[model samples]
Target: MSGKPKLHYFNGRGRMEPIRWLLAAAGVEFEESYLEKKEDLTKLQKDGSLLFQQVPMVEIDGMKLVQTRAIANYIATKIDMYVEGMFDLNELLMMYVIQPADKKEEYFANMMDKAENRYFPAFEKVLKDHGKDFLVGNQLSRADVQLLEVILMAEEYNPSILAKFPLLQSFKARISNIPTIKKFLQPGSQRKPRTTEEDVARAMKIFRS
Candidate 1:
């Protein structure tokens, strides 16, 4: 609210990544408190900082927001439908990212097939049908920010994923070039890098233990 929002989550991106994306896209600077160890989470729970005793929480507007959808809604008041769709895509990608190393290849293939055939085409059509740079109205919205995040995640797996979709390619280019988003995309920015095997293992140890 008055001061910069503080985010509480793991160092790597999970649900909080999209919230970071939205805030960055809006040009809002925030701080992060990463849960690096089990005690870090246990402390929060003991202190009652977590309403649901779970994370992806945000301290904004003098309130502690939990639940990914609720936090996203608070950040981006409108544009639920598109945000939900993009988040659905994000979850699919997350599933692949955290898969076992031996099973990653198969999961990656299945996830790509769904993304290319089902998800990407739907968003591509929304852009083409509207003939606008953003998925919703002429200006950027939460939908646009979330979609851009999803597109980048997809491209990390396949650099040429957008080759078949010219509109999405242009959309990604347009969104990435925005001054705030451009800054966030830079190296060393708060934006987390693609999750790695070590990151996944660490997260599992923290949450599953």
Candidate 2:
């Protein structure tokens, strides 16, 4: 993996999952360093030289990149994974879901409201109108994976949340089926998903008010 770029993320699935799958699907080797606990966090802070205050940072030949979307886009661009207008369309999709009630504090307060029935239809509509096989054409792209992350997160609140969207399910299956991605699905490569669920619950407890 030293020969290729490296990606740093907490052991939980979180936002990094889709981007990691994107790089793997490209058949490109990358360093998938899983961080957990206070020490792991401190060590990453020490050695990571973070370009952004985010996990899923990619270091290509020692250059660091941050932001889940940016990381996805960078890998997508390197492998030409983006579709026509998909780049912009995907951004629009993200904004539609997050729907910052307060642009200044969007990331902090936005997710609390998402547990309701507000945005799922928007996503389903986009996936349905765009077709099920992918968000764009036949090949998988960053948009597909990002949507997968959203779907997975939504599952925390309701497993049936995305059941209506067959294409999105197909897209999730497609990424999970990849050889490299499949490997990460095994129990040991990363932290157990149940732990991530716990983290989500703890975060939501604060927003539950």
Best by TM-score: 1
Candidate 2 lDDT tens digits, 85-186: 333333333343334355625542444345334455555566678665666567776666555655555565456755666665666777777676677666
Off by over 4 Å in 2: 33-48, 52-56, 77-116, 178-180, 191-209
Residue 134 CA error for candidate 2 (Å)? 1.0
- Model 2 TM-score, all chains together: 0.58
Give per-model TM-scores: 0.96, 0.58
Error of 2 at 27 (Å): 3.1
Residue-level lDDT for 100 in candidate 2: 38
| Candidate 1, poorest ten consecutive residues by summed lDDT | 76-85
Which lDDT values do the candidates have, in the order given? 0.89, 0.57
